[model samples]
Each structure stands twice: as C-alpha cells, then as structure tokens.
Target: MTTTGKIVIVGGGVTGLTTGVALLEAGLPVHLVAAEIPGPTSVAAGAMWGPYLVEPWAKVRRWSLVSLDVFRGLSDAPATGVRMVSGIEAARNAVSAPEWNTLLLGFRECSPGELPTGFEGGYRFTVPLIDMPVYLQYLLRRFREAGGTMQRQFVGSLDEIDDGSVIVNCAGLGAGELAADDSVRPIRGQHVVVKNPGITEFFSEDTGLSPDLVCIYPHGETVVLGGTAIDGEASLQEDRVAARAIVERCAAVEPRLAKAPVVASRVGARPTRSEVRVEADSRSDGAPVLHNYGHGGSGVTLSWGCAQEIVQLVTATG
Candidate 1:
C-alpha cells in the first residue's frame, strides 16, 4: 500500500521526474511543484558515458549504472528515447591514467598502428544515453496515470510546502537558492544539434582546450556535436565561437559530420557541487525535506540510482 502523507518534489528536471516515477510505481501519492516549464533535458542527445578528466562520485556512477539498466528494460516507450551506445576513448598522450582506464570494458594497450594519435592508447565500452524529451513526457504521463499531481507553481522555500509533507528538492541549480546551497554553481554546457550523420557511436576528446571542445553523439533524428564547460556562467546565450570550434574539431575527428546541416543549438547549465547532496532536511513544521540535486554533467548518467536512494531515505523516515 502507498504511504499516508503527500510527498512533494521540487524541480521538474531529470531528478524530480525520475523520483516521481519511482514513487508512483511504488504506490506513493506524489505532488510535483516547479517554478519553470519543463523543456530540454528530456530530449537531450542522451549519451550516458563517463570517467573523464574529473573523478566522479562513486555513488553517482553507481546510480548511472542502475539507470542504464532501467532505460534498457523499457520497450514500449521508444520515444522515451533511450538506447545503448558503444563508445571509444583515445588519448593523444602516452601516459596511462588508472582511474579513467579502469572504467572502460576493454581497458588495454593499443598497438602503435591502432594508436592513431598525437600519442597514447585507447579503450572501448558501451553505456546508455537517454533522450530527455521523450523520457520527460513519459514521466509526466506516468505520474498523471498513477494519480500524481504536478503544478507550475515555483516554490520559494521549503516552508511553502504543507505541514507533515515530505519535500524533495530536485530543482537542479535552482536548489542553490531554494535549499540555500551556496556551493551550487552553474556549469554551462553548450551543444550544436545537426541532422543525423547515420553514425551510431559516440566519440569525445579532452585536450583541455580553451572556450570549448568536441563531443559527438548520434541520436535518433540528429547528432549532438559540442560542449563548452564555462563554470559560473549562467548566460543561456549561444557561443558561436565555441560552436564553430566544436564543429571544426568534430569534423576533424570524423569529416562526414562536416556535411551535416546544423539544425539547432542548445545551452544548459550543469548544476555542479563539490559533493552531490542527497540527504534529509526538515521544513519549519518538522516535515522531511530530501535534497537531491548536483549531478552536474552527469544528471542523465545518474538519475535512477539517486532516485532509489531518495526512496529509501523517505521510506526509512516513515
């Protein structure tokens, strides 16, 4: 049976939607309140790969793995836009890095001939990529069917929730304000969407260049080519210089993409923190408040695992 009290989830991004879906599936009555209209992350290029220049949180990786499986199991909602993708990682340097090396499936030494670059070896593996748009709609539909209620009301504070109700803060960067988390800063990521190049794989490079770098992932109708990680930058404006650099870099990697037409550009701020917060707080009336944001560039990569833990936190509280 479902629980007795109402559970309100804040933020309409991946974390909020996934938490709502999990709760509803478990027969819990849920209500979602957001100050903004839901749009893009659900329809993202959806590539779930990781272990790059940065050392990601272990829990985050675990959650991403679990989410990878969940997205893989769903068949009917092909539009939820999830798919398993094989990826290749190559470095221009010969130095071996253990942390990133171990994350791949076939972590091995590449022959000189195979090592086609400015220097080093390579690795390969497969992971899930979620089409955020399809997944978001699917989530909304599922929540509605399970009797969950959602509104466009922007919650100013945790006290705005009713007494005795559990409030989950999944407001993404908005949590910096909503949860009073000063560490939550916006890491802006910009992408260029192009017509499909008929490529099914994902390729990325990390030379630690200037304003941007190249990341190419092919989806159902289009290919995502881009990425500039501008920390503390909140401007949603498109960076054409960065966009052109990305296109040029990507085209250099695989010249075929050069011919594809640019359909659109996207800018999203990855909510980053020194540590991803997923703990319980309390409303003024002593109602439980669960904080679950800060997945940064890995939100899609880590949704389910985080939601599962949040469910456990809420369940244990009762």
Candidate 2:
C-alpha cells in the first residue's frame, strides 16, 4: 500500500488546506481537490479558539491545546488573522471551571461584578480569535507558497479517484456519503455580522447542550454575533429571524451592540458526529485513505492538531 506518489487531499476547507500546508511543509508532494475552496462552513465560523460541542474529551483536549499553541504563535502576525483577545465565557447557571482552563493565558475566575447580569458563573481568559475569512485566505496562500496545487472539482466517491496516491478525506459534511458513515450529520449554525462598536474583547454565553448559542467575536471593524445550532438542518440560507435574535442577544450582553448596523449574515452547516473521526482506512483496491473531519464547531480549533496527526499517520503507514 506504499509507493512514491503525491498525496491527494479531498476537500479544501480549513481541514484540507491546513493538512496540505502541513504535508507540504513536511516536504511531501500534495494536491488538493474540492468543490469549493475556503469552504463556506469554515468561512462562516465565529471562530474563537475554544473547543465547543466536540467529543472524546481526552483527544480533543490534546488536539485543542496543540492548535492553541500554533494559534498563539500566529497571533504575532496580524496578516494571519489570528489575534490574542481577552474575554469572558460565562453561563446563566452556576458552573465549575473547565479542565482546560489552565491551558489558556490569563485564566481566572470572574468576580461577581465582572459577570454579566444573568450569568451566575464564568471565567476570564485570553485566546486566539481568528477572523476566518482572512485566516482561510492566509492558509490558502501558505499552502500554495509551500508548492501545493489545488483543483476545483467535486469528488463523488473515493473509488473515482484512482491515481494510486494515498487519499486524505476531509470532506466535512460530504463525508457522510463519501465514507458511507451515517453518524455524520449537519448541525446548522447561523451568525450575524455587524459593524464593531469600538469593542475590543470577546464575550460568550456557555450554552451547554442547547441549540441556541450566544457569542460575540469582534474582528476589528466587524463583529460576528452568533448563533443557533439546529441539528439535522443542512440549509445554508440565512435566517432573518435567527439573525435578528443573534443581534438582540449580543446587544443584551453588550449594550453598544444595540445600535450597531448590520454588516452581513452568515450560515454554515457544521459537520457533526458523535466523535471526531481521524482514522486510517484502505479502499477495496488497497489504497490507503485517511479520514479527518467531524470537528463539529471546533474545526478551526482542531485544524492544526488534526493535520499533524494525519501527517503522522501517513508517515507511519509508509
């Protein structure tokens, strides 16, 4: 199952692009094929550096920490669209600190006065807040600069690709059909973008298993307010009602947002599974295939770590 052929990566979202960059930097020949580059799901993310609604806690924690380290280094370069921002993540109900709190900078328990009106418990920390649109482009440029090639084509099946090259599937939601894995499903997320009202920090309400989420991530001039997480919803169309609710919820947390004018709206269907799948498989023809998808809402948070693991798998199998 090993030969001297270039690595063929499927899907051009953050997962695929980041994987390509890692492989190319590792000095492997790589080519990417996807239906869309800077995938809508990745771009639409209100991408803060925190593991949300992801599973297999032990591995997720390790992967998230690895990504956090990379993002911290990237924060120094503004062109990468990664910024170290201070913020509060509080919940309406009393809660204990998360085990990963120690991994963040400036980790502290929020004083009662610092907690927003309804939040009964929370924490203060500094983490990378990625502006996805800019960050995705950065990844693409880095990928190309590393001598990686890209082809804009939809992959209907893994068998269709018979180039004799090892395949890495990062098809996100599309993996459901491609891998015939029924566990993968869509968790639709919507967010509202508004002109920043001089806000420099981020704020998020810890919405435990609830479908409705409240988070505000500001990217300089524009702030992304999110959102709703409806399981089994795959539509990418913007929901005006959801947009308005997002703005209202964010405004309730930060009064200045009440007057902020609407800049745009975004909708993305997060590819979710009971647990993230990052394993190796072989096609009927014996070509090795690596699966790297189902990061759920933490695609950006887990990208680098997952990619690094994929590179390891490639190295190990060879």
Candidate 3:
C-alpha cells in the first residue's frame, strides 16, 4: 500500500534483517529498530538449511523451498557464508523418509554402509549450510547499502509505535510481550563450537521429539556441534553440562570430533509457537502490522521465504 513513511521492522535477527533486505530490494524505504542488531541468537545457530522443528508443513515446505533456492544462489558468493554441502540425516531407530526429501538436490536413501555405525535409517542430500556470524553481517551490509536505516533501541510495545508506517513484527521471542502473543515462547538451544579437525561434510541425527540433538556442522576452521531444545526455557546463559553433552554426542557419531579442541559455546532461545505466524494485523492506532515470527529452529531455514511473503503483504496493503 501507499505509505507516508518507511516500513518499520522490529527484531533484528535473521528474520528482521532478511525482511529489511527484501523490502529494500523491493525499492521500499525501510527502517529497522532493535535492542541489538545482528542478534546473538542468530549468530549462535547451527544454521544448516534443512527445516528442523518448525510446523505447518504445507507452508513451511513452500517457504523452505523458496529459501533453499535463494541460498543456493547466494552460495556462489563466498562473502555470504552460504555453502552447498552434502550431508546425512540419520536416525538410530527405523523411520520414514522426510516428506521434504524430494525438494533437495540429489535426494537418496542412505545405504547401510553410508549410515553411521548405529544409525538404522537415514537420507543423503545437499543443502545450504550457513556461517551465521558472517552471513548476518552480509545481510546487514546489504541492508545499509540499499539505503535502509537502523536504530539500536528497545521497542517496548506496539502502542509506542504511532508513526503512519507499516509495522513488521519480527520481534521473535520478544513478540510474546510486544504483540501479547502468549503462544510465543522460547525453546532453549545450546551449541558448542569446536576446532574442525579436517572435516568437510555435515552430519545430523534425526532425533524426532527428543529435546537433545546431535549434529556436527563444519565451517572451515571451526565446527558447530549441537544441540538441545528445551521448551519454555528462555535463559541464554551457557550451560556447561549441555555443552559437554553436545560434544560427547557428536563425538560418538564422528570419531574425529573426539579430540577436537573446544572453541566456544552458544545458547539461544528459539522463538517457538504452535505454528509459525506470518500474517497481517493492525495496531490500536490503525497502522498496518505484519506478524513474522515463531520460526522455532527454522528461522534461518525460512527467513527469505517469510521475508518475500512479508513483501507481498506490504504490497497487498497498498
């Protein structure tokens, strides 16, 4: 729709930044405000591009595929920190192939020999694995270069935003308070970064419905080992116990990780909901509002697709 001012996007994680970039690329004026841009949580992700624990498979499938295509294009640019890496996602118990397997390149069931020692069933495919820290900066730079502006300030409530601007509520976990969305809660995730001992491919355990996850993602010199998904847990403090467990679990699957020196630990609370929110609303002051959060573990996986949808929502409003 026709706007009197620039679009204001809340939350500055991958969701907000990606949305900001999309809007700018669409030739719209955009302003992003957040307490912290390039949010720590986004930086701390084991951000391989397979939809993990997000929901509403129908829409997620579409969004994830769109993002997969975009990431594939971005992979050609090393500065974007996107890579097309082949990997195995296996399970210790018998399981059906993932419904989205057909969406990836070179989709195939892993042969028994291809499966790690204890994995009973799994699939092999190539997907974009992101180095989040570098990627976030790339997004930020792209946003600024496109003439988008940002403010590093706390946005307490939607009511405080009275400007006649379209509001994109990407506040993530903060949406629980800003939008009064009780369904929005935190799913605590922890990852351990270890020195990469000459590894190239990625590996993940298909731990369905389990709080603990086993995954190893190598990014050049460092590998990110993950993770835990504790629902309703919001604390960002590093959990040594969880870190140790992550390293041990990964080491079991990839013996080379056994002696990898510990580098760092990361903890983030995924903004999880019963289903992802990517729709429109209105503020009390009658300003247009678009909700785009609750991505859970698939924030990076769904960022671009969701951003594109937001762009359409903005156009429809006009």
Candidate 4:
C-alpha cells in the first residue's frame, strides 16, 4: 500500500487525541493507534493555569490560553465536566522568572483569608481544570465524527506507521523507548478521588513537606485531592502509602475535606521532559514525523495549542 493518503498518529493519550482533533479541523484524515484499550485521559490533582509555571516553554502559556478558549467553545463543555475555576496558587518565595502569573485574568494577590500556612503570599486566578476522563471522551468523539480512524495495536517503532507519508508522534512516556528520547522520563503523580459534597471549590498551596503541596478540586461526582510529583518514577501500582499521604496533606489544607470518603486512588506517569516538544523531525528510518509530546504535567492544560502547532507542521509538510 502507498503511504500518502492519510496521517498516522501514535498514542491515544490527551496529546494524541487533541492533535487528532486539530488535524481533522485543519482538513486532514488521521489513523490513531495504541497498544492498550483506547481509553480516557487521566492523572494529576489540579491543572495549573498561566504561563509562569511552565518555565522556559513560554509558548506553553500561550498555547494554554488558546486551548482554554477552544475547550470553552466546545458544545460539550458542561457535559464533559470542564469548568472555569478559580484557585489559590501560592509560593514560599517567587522564582526568578515566573512563566504564567501575568497571563491569567484576575491574577492578583490572594486575600489574607485564602492564604495557607507556610506560604508568604501569592495570587489567585481563574483557570480551566480538565476532567480528563470526560475531556478525552469528548476528543475521541470529535475525532470519530470528523472521519478519523483508530487501530488497537502497539507500535514499537516508527516503521509501523508506513501507511502514511507523515506521522505525528504523541506517544507520551513511550517516546523514551520508541524514539530513543532520553529526555522523556516519567514523573509519577498520585491522587485520591473522594466523595465530598462539602468541598465545592479548589484550594492549593506550596507546602514544603512530604507529598509536597495539596490541591482540592470538585469534578461533579468526585472530588480530586492531590498530589505528589516523584520525578523519574514510573510506577502505576497505586501506592497505599502515597494515597494516605495525599489525603492527609489535603485535609490539612482544608479541614472540611477531612470528613470526605475516599472513593478511589489513581496513579499515572506523566510524560515529562525539560520542555514541551511540538516540532517536526524525521524518525530514525526517515519517516516524516512531527513530535508533540513531553507535556509533563500540563498535557490537558496546553493540548489544543500544541495540537494547532502540530497540525500546522503536518499541513505545511503535506
């Protein structure tokens, strides 16, 4: 078969799905393949807003801005459970260059009441938090509606995508092995989803302690309490110790949540790199490949913008 009519995308994570949506929007056909059951997106406690947190990837902040608008415009925003939320983001002392604070609406000082212990002072901003399970389903639905196709198979290398002239790789942590990308290591994040009706808002702080900071956000049926960032860790076995640590730290931040029933615990390895990669390159076997991985902890936060860039790269090459 000739490798020219369609584009093949590897991976079914948030990055892959969003890139598929963007490419379809740009008038292209896509075939997405993954090893596991094509499932929903997940991991992490809260989605941090603004560009300041992303460090050198200042474009990530811009991409996040555009992505928020895209998600807000989607017809299923309410059905998919995405919400424009306000949260308290604190820091003990400011980093030399914050990447995102100034980019948000109402980015200003948090009132004395919102301040948690150990935080000197910080800002409050309204940002979008993605309920990944819902959002991933939304993206998959859109891709199917746009005439995209999916295959269930593990692609161990770039050669497996020979059905297309161009392949966009968004394979998350798999890139570490598949692409021989040493930078694409996993950052393990553990969180607890609880049944808490009393916690209606999101609260977070930069506490320098075990399990580090705490963030609590409501997602319709469940409340997300999180989390800890264990860099270079790739275990998804749901550590009981980590789960208990998350719950305790979160309750310490918001005493009311202490009474909430823990519904379930989840662990995911975030595909992390020093920077978010959304550039075009050739695979080892000389297949045209556009890489759109390394989202780290911000995959959902900046999906659309990076997708847009990926689509542009593919289109320009085509």
Question: CA lDDT of each candidate?
Answer: 0.72, 0.91, 0.91, 0.73
Error of 4 at 195 (Å): 0.7
Instruction: Locate the minimum summed-lDDT window of 10 residues in model 2.
Output: 1-10
Kindly provide the TM-score of model 4 when superposed on the true structure, using C-alpha atoms: 0.90
Task: Judge candidate 2 at residue 253 and give its lDDT.
Answer: 94
Per-residue C-alpha lDDT of model 4 across residues 43-134, encoded as one tens digit per residue: 34355444423434658767987887876666345866577777776766652223566666677887667787666676777777667666
Q: What value does the lDDT take at residue 142 in candidate 4? A: 83
Winner on TM-score between 1 and 3 is: 3
Evaluate model 4: give its lDDT: 0.73
* Displacement of the residue 120 alpha carbon in candidate 3, Å: 0.9
lDDT of 2 by residue, 172-273 (tens): 999778888999999999999999999998999988888889999999999999999999999999999888888998899999999999999988999999
Residue 24's lDDT in candidate 4: 80
List TM-scores for all candidates, in order: 0.88, 0.97, 0.97, 0.90
Badly placed stretches (over 4 Å) of model 4 are 1-4, 37-45, 48-55, 92-97, 207-211
Query: Which pairs clash in model 4?
Result: 51-99, 51-100, 52-99, 52-100
**Cα lDDT for residue 179, candidate 1:** 81
